[model samples]
Target: MVDNNWLAPVWTLFQQQPLAQGIGLAAMLVGISAFRQRDDGRFRLRLCLYQGAIAFHFLLMGASTAALSAGLSCVRTVASGHTRSPWVMAFFLLLVWGLGIPGINSPVQWLPIIGTTIGTWGLFRAKGIVLRLSMLAGGLCWTSHNILIGSIGGSLIELSFLFVNCHTMYRMWRQPLPNPS
Candidate 1:
């Protein structure tokens, strides 16, 4: 097991800056997706497992976004019925969060420190905006043709969505609210 030095790397992750965080978060999603994504069903089972790893890594980033008003899982929580077999992706995200035990809003996204800050607001509204924004950013990132960097930046959109879903679920159950007029 690691000691104090373990925390050292936590701070060291690309999460210390806005661009890094954005690029890092996106890359993480692509990495996870690449780890599992398959154009064909030649390896459905394996790809499924790889997808989980991808989600898990993002989950780590989400947990790190503490009180930053951003948690990708919260978006996932909001968009449950829209996707197919999302629980699988969601579970994988949880795995990484458990492993990393990271800090909040630490240079994880690109332009935004905690993209989920803005994303959370949009996702919480429960409109289609979250997915649309995610897709749009991802598309723009792809069109930029930066290859590796773009892939990461783009993929972050989905990664954040996955995190927001689970995060919100926890909040809904954990935090109580007062009656409204």
Candidate 2:
């Protein structure tokens, strides 16, 4: 409720510094690489938890600068050509934009909740690896949201899950790129 201006650009020492920009670019590269490698994993994990992941990323739009940054970073990354590489992950991004972006200035933060509930069935019915990862990603999504919403344990837990998720994704990337559908 307080006016915490997270978006207000502060003129700190490193404002517009080349190092910062380069760091962002490098991180984007790494993030992009990480994402590319983990397409199936991210897709699998998120697919496993698609409903909740969609809800978590969607409902939390504009809730915090961190949320916005992450959300927009997702958009920009896709726009910059990562999500485009793997078509399935694009569906995940679509989920983010569809249920989440409109919440930027609206009161309907619960849309994803309903959508995810409906969507979860598909994942639940999915057999084998995809289904399993979806379940894990869903739990991760829920936990990430809880952490973002002020759960102290959530952050720590999310970080650990993220570490594993990232590791798996990176490994997937290191392997040969799958045949694009």
Candidate 3:
């Protein structure tokens, strides 16, 4: 018989931390909506909301590294909206490594750091399709981390993010390029 015991941990998390899971689910909705926005400003605003919510969700679930990453992401996403300065990007990148390095108990902890680094680069250096593509990569990293950490809502959100981001990219790609002045 196939082992069906893997779900026990997921169920236990649900039973133990229903509130955190609910927050994650809500964050997922916000993130999905964020990607659907055609305007970059709206996308960044909504994504910042998602990052904040997910940070709290990770904190409640005892994923400190992931929480830290998400927290920084919240700030970074907002900053990206205001400026795409390389100096700002460098600062956030340093912050991620500085804050995230000491928490390394296992290799799994690296996922959030790597994801956040890529996201920081994307947010500061790129726009539109390139930005979303970087987010897709970051989502993959988060998905693996969530699954390893037994975060039901976290896993679901990353998985959904991948699909939604791809669809949004396709939509953006179909639009004609804007005329440069």
Candidate 1 vs. true structure, TM-score: 0.26
lDDT of 2 by residue, 74-172 (tens): 443333233333344445546556655665543333332332332243233443334335534554554555444543323334454556555664564
TM-score of each: 0.26, 0.27, 0.92
The Cα local distance difference test for each model comes to 0.37, 0.40, 0.91
* Model 3, residue pairs in steric clash: none
Put down candidate 1 lDDT per residue, 1-181, tens digits, no spaces. Answer: 6579755544554445445455445445443442232221222233233334433433444432221212333334334334434454444345324433344233333322233223323323333334334423433432232223323433454454345433434453466334348
How well does candidate 1 score on lDDT at residue 20? Answer: 41
- Model 1 stretches astray by more than 4 angstroms: 1-53, 58-106, 109-113, 129-131, 134-181
Q: How accurate is candidate 3 locally (lDDT)?
A: 0.91
lDDT for each residue of candidate 3 in 67-159, tens digit (9 for 90 to 100)? 999999999999989998999999999999999989889999999999999999999998889999999998899999999998888999999
Candidate 2 vs candidate 3: the lDDT winner is 3
**Error at 124, model 3, angstroms:** 0.4
RMSD versus native structure for model 3: 2.6
Candidate 3's C-alpha runs over 4 A off are 1-9, 177-181
